[model samples]
Target: MRLLRVELSRFFSRRAVAMLLLAAALLTALVAGTTIWGTRPVDAAEQARAEARVQAITSSPEYKRDLANCQESPEDLFGPGADAADCRRLLAPSTADVVGRVPLALADEVDDSGIAVIVIVTVLMIVAGTTFAGADWASGSMSNQMLFEPRRQRVWWAKAGAALVGTGVAAAVLIAAFWVALYLVADARGIGTGAAVQTDIRWMVARGVSLAALAGFGGYALTMLLRHTVGTLAVLFVYAAGGEALISLLPVERSGQYSPAENVFAWIRDGGRVFDSSIDCPVSSAGCDQTFQLTLLHGGAYLAVLVLLVTVVSAVLFQRRDIP
Candidate 1:
């Protein structure tokens, strides 16, 4: 307990951690402010005017003709496999979109914001964890500390505890602020703040918090094994950003489902259909079709397994390896 306390105090005192937390807050505010600016609230009269214009445009002969032409056009002329996104874009009511007077903030927008927060906070946690472990070695402080404590695993546990606590606290605060800002924007924009919205909020909050915490812990474990900061961040970025994209190009079934990003997103989105999946038709599809890689519960369980594996491996290596 004393060791943990010491670690926590030190963790909180670090300038890097402080900077990371501040950056997270500022970025959240910036995003919220920008969102609110772009979707600023409109009076009923303005909404009516916008809707009227939208109706006129959609009902216009030109738009209707273009819509028809796009639907009936050949795929070879449009470049290839054009039967997917064309009609959906053309037919979706512009007035009902983000700039439109949509009643409720869509589930997808909430998921998008949640994913952004998770990515931001998750990387911070990983960097914090790596620096927490790597700094002592870099500064030649670990040997001196070991002279007093001697037990390397105990030291590792204390640092890990401190990392989790710091990250948990940071993530909770950041996510809460972002969610609040989101609803404020929603409410001000006259988007429905109804039961369904609240339910999505609840779902996102639960999954976002859990995902951030778990990913942070995983980051901590990886840093402990690597014992450096640069390599850890590089590997994490590749895993988080590039891993899924590279894998997605493969013509493999369910390719998107099993990636780290998709699995976490599966839980974040509550197992709803995800992005970059197939569309019903490129231009003239009658209906949209979608599928989930994993159910909500399964995605959660898979992530838990991943975090556990990283943690166990780190602990084993920490116990066996001589402190550098």
Candidate 2:
């Protein structure tokens, strides 16, 4: 318990961690402010110009080419090998009318903008966790800490507990603040804050916190295993940013589920009526019209396995290798 407390104190003592927390809070507040500000009505002329731009894009030569290709390869283009209604919506002539909106509803605002908070929180937690653990190694302070308490595994557990507690507290607070701000904005914008909307907000907050904690755990485990904070960060950024191309290289159909990036979204969207179709044809050339095919339990299990494997490896390394 003393070691854990010391670890937590060391974590909070870092200026970078404080800055990261500050940055996360400021950015979340900015998101809320922008979301509220976004509700302000646009001028008629501006709305007209936006509608015209959509009309132009829908009718553009490039869009026509894609539509022609989609018609030729509808299944390959979207999913189920053909008849992707959602995909077809994009190519349809009525898309311009579909794109134009006079008033954004409260539900729509939450659905559209709440995703940003999830993304920001998850990524922030991952980076913070990595640096939180990796900083000790980066500073060559792990050896000195171990001189005080030589049990590497104990140190590891302490660091993880500290990381998780930090992530959980931050996630809960930010998610609450974000939704509360959104709710107030929705009410002010003349949108009804109905029971259904509130229910959705509650669910979103729960998922956001879960994802953030998962990211933090994974980040800490990976950094501890490698003992190379910069390398861990680089790999994460690449996976988060360029994982799609790598996912494409996989020959398996519905291979998107194999990617952590996609599964994170799947975990967030699990059991929601967000996807138009749930059927996935991974064995067939027809695409999975489904949103992410993995269930929340499966995604959580997969992520847990990943973090567990890395943590086990990290523990072994910490025990066998000298801290440099």
Candidate 3:
């Protein structure tokens, strides 16, 4: 308990971690602010402009020609069973379409700005974790710390715990703040988020926080193994870029299912679909689609396995290897 407390205090006291957390907060605020500003209720002037644009588009010769053709051959444009009524409904221009702006929607932001904020925080936390561990090695303080504690395993786990707890708490606070800001903005604008959407947002925030914590743990482990911040980052960069490209090149079924990025997104989004264009389709087979569903369970398992492997290897090496 004493060691863990010490490590936690050290983790939070690091300047690098402090700066990264501040950056994450600022970035989250920026994203939330942008979403609110961009999605603000369309003013009277904008509404009038949109209405004028819609009127102009509806009265245009090109639009008239397209509408005429659609009504005459609705099935051709809209597939079988599509009638002239469908053409009329689809061809009509609306002020909403012309304005191309929507009021703040919590549900939509969950998939958009929400995901972006999570990714940003996750990346920064990874760096924070790496920096925290790498600093010990870089400053040759690991040797001194070990001289005091002597039990390498305890030290290892203490640092890992500190990284995980610190990163997770930071992520949760920032993500919750982001959501609160958006929600308040929406409420002030008379927009209501559905109960279902609120539930989804909560689940998303939980998953995002967990993902970030794990990522930070992984970064710390990798840095411990490599004993250099840049080395760990370089390795991650190569794997992220090269690994996906290599997976795409492999002639395997549902190649995209193995992509780390795809799985990460799947985990973040609960579940996601991946389209593998590399899948060879038989010419004789019609409507051959190459989309595959990646469940959250699959993504969660893959990430868990990967981080476990790295953490284990790193701990084992740190225990056995000689500290310079």
Candidate 4:
């Protein structure tokens, strides 16, 4: 209990930690505000003005001729018999197609807000976990901690457990707070309420918290093994930014199975856009179409393997190494 309280006090005393929490809150508000305002439905007057402008273009004689010519050869961009003037005909908005394409949820708004929250929460958790563990070793605090505890493995587990629980609680609170703010903003903007929308919001919050926990654990493990803040941060930054970007550039087919990035990206689904996948295929590939159902299973398995390997290796290293 004494050790736990001491750790908690030290964690909260850091200015950087406080700043990160504040930043997450501010970012959540900003993203939610933008999403709600930007995607609000146009008023009838605004729609009418747009319609008038479209009518002016489509009612022209050139537009009529163009429509007639297009009817004869719909796919051809230009040909010997093509009427150049008619080719510029303004298209009438097809109600059928518009209605058919209407998404079940407001994707732009949800994604804009949801993705920002996820990223901020995840990054903060990772940074906190890494620095908390690594700082002890870097500053020679671990020697004292271990000396006090005597049981090296217990000391290690205590730190890891505290980090996991603390970060997880912080993530949950932030995510829930963000979700409530978003819902209120969305309601104010008169976005239609539905069970589906509520479900999506819940799912987003849940996933954000889960991902944050995963990132925190992963960072903690890395810090334990590396025993240096600089090294841990370097490796994490490389994996999170450079590694993912490089993997994205590879041929779609080759990347799906081999890229670690793909393994982590399979949990987000806002409306029709699926954010995360467990399948080992490029997101844009035909393979995704065929293997969509298998994504969650594959992704879970992969993440489990990675977490197990990293945790075991880090534990072994920490147990064997002398504190500097």
Candidate 5:
């Protein structure tokens, strides 16, 4: 407990970690601000201008000619069972379509801006974890710290615990603040979110927090194993980018199932679909289908296995390997 407390202090005290956390917070705020600004309620003047534009378009001679043509043979324009009313309704552009300033919708944001913020935070946390661990090795402080606490495993775990806990708490706070700010804006604008949508948002936040924390933990473990910041980052980059491409070359069916990005998004979104072109269709090209459903369980399990393998190997190696 004492060692963990000390390591936790070190984790927070690091300059890189502090900057990364600040960056995450700034990014969250930026995303929230952008979403709110982009989706601000359409003003009266804007609405009137949009209505005028629509009226102008509908009143044009070209529009009249097209409408008349469509009314003559609605089946040619909109397939069978269409009429003059259908032409009038479908041909005219609405004010909303012209204005294009949609009101803030929390449910839609969950799938769009919410995922973006989560991804940003997760990437920053990964860097935070890597730098925190890498600093000790780079400065040759790990050897000195071991002298005070000779048990290597205890020291390793204390550092790991600090990295995990600190990153997890920071992620939770940032992600929650993001949603809370947006929710308040939505409330002030009189845009109500249903109980079901709120529930979904909460669950998504929970999953996002977990994924970010684990990503940080994985970064720390990988750095510990490699003992160099750039080496760990390079490995992660290759695995993230090259691994997906390599998997595609394999003859395995549903090769996208092995992609880290796919599983990560699936875990964050609760579930997702993957399309693999490598899947050999049994019949003609017309009969080919490549899309496959990826469940939350599969994503969770895949991520857990990856983190577990890296952590176990890192811990085992740190126990026996010489630290410089």
Candidate 6:
């Protein structure tokens, strides 16, 4: 109990945590306000204007020419002509097709911009968790802690548990606040209580929480193994940024499933494409050809195994290593 309190105090005492929490709150507010309050509700006037614009563009000679070129291209159909046809076919779909495919209500409810803020917050929280355990050892605080509690393993476990719990609480509070704020804004905007909004918000929040928890546990494990803040942070940044980008660019499709970050993203997307505007598979593609498919259960299992392995390793190290 004493160890848990001490760990919590140390975590909250850091200025970085406070600043991160504040920034997350502010960004959440901005996203909710802009998405729910700023945009006008879609009505007959808007629909008519959109229809008229679509008609005007599709009726244009350029659009007709491109469509004809695509139809005539052998690339889309057969040989050398197929290449030219394929190029022409890359043009945007007809406005009518786009409209037919779009879910205007879902589009209105979704704040795609919120995704950036959520990712940033998750990364920051992971950093905080990674440093929480290893920083004590690096700074010689572990010596004092061990002196007070002779069971080094216990002390390490307590610290890990405390960091996990603290981070989880902070994440939950921020998300809950954001949810309420968004709901209020949505109500004010007269968006109406619809199944789509309800479903999307529920899924987003649930997945966001799971992602944060996974990040927290993973960060803790990495820091425990590395034991140096700079090294751990560097590795985390590489994995979070460069590693994922490289994985995405790989020519081989199956290679992606093995990449940790890609799996995490797949988990977040819940088997769907990450963005509505982007198609996971190209036009005429039969199905999603992801290198890896991650279910929530799979992600949970991976995280659990990682957390258990790191905790065991760290405990052993704590028992065997000399206090600095």
Which numbered prediction scores highest in TM-score against the true structure? 5
lDDT of 3 at 212: 95
Q: 1-324 in candidate 6: lDDT tens per residue?
A: 887888788877767666766776677667666655444455676677767777787789998887777776546544553565465545545544534433224334445644554566577678778767667757877788777899876777677777677677777777666666666655776556677767876787677776775677667767776778778889877866887677667776454554566556555555533322122577777765543445666655655676677777867876787877
lDDT of 4 at 287: 41
Candidate 3 lDDT tens digits, 27-110: 998998899888978889999999889889889999999999999889998999999999878889888888887888899998
Please give the distance, in angstroms, between residue 65's alpha carbon in candidate 1 and its true position after superposition.
Answer: 9.7
Q: Compose the digit string of candidate 4's lDDT tens values, residues 136-247.
A: 8777888888777988777777777767776777889888877776566556766665787677777877777877877777788888998877798898778768877776
C-alpha TM-scores of all predictions: 0.74, 0.74, 0.94, 0.74, 0.97, 0.69
Q: Looking at model 4, report the run of 10 residues with the lowest lDDT sum.
A: 95-104
Clashing pairs in 5: none
lDDT of 1 by residue, 1-324 (tens): 999999989887888778877887788777666656655556787778778888888889987887777778636346677773666474647654624533436454585556777668766766776777667766778778888898878988898888888778887888877878778767766676678877877777767776766666777788778777777788888877888777777676556666776677678777756554642335666554545446787778878897788788889987888875
lDDT of each: 0.73, 0.76, 0.93, 0.68, 0.93, 0.65
> Over all chains combined, what TM-score does candidate 4 have?
0.74
Query: Which run of 10 residues does model 5 get worst, by summed lDDT?
Result: 280-289
lDDT of 4 at 225: 91
TM-score of 6: 0.69
Q: What local lDDT score does residue 192 receive in model 1, on the 0 to 100 scale?
A: 62
lDDT of 1 at 247: 73
Q: What is the C-alpha RMSD of each candidate to the true structure, in Å?
A: 7.0, 8.0, 1.7, 6.3, 1.4, 7.4
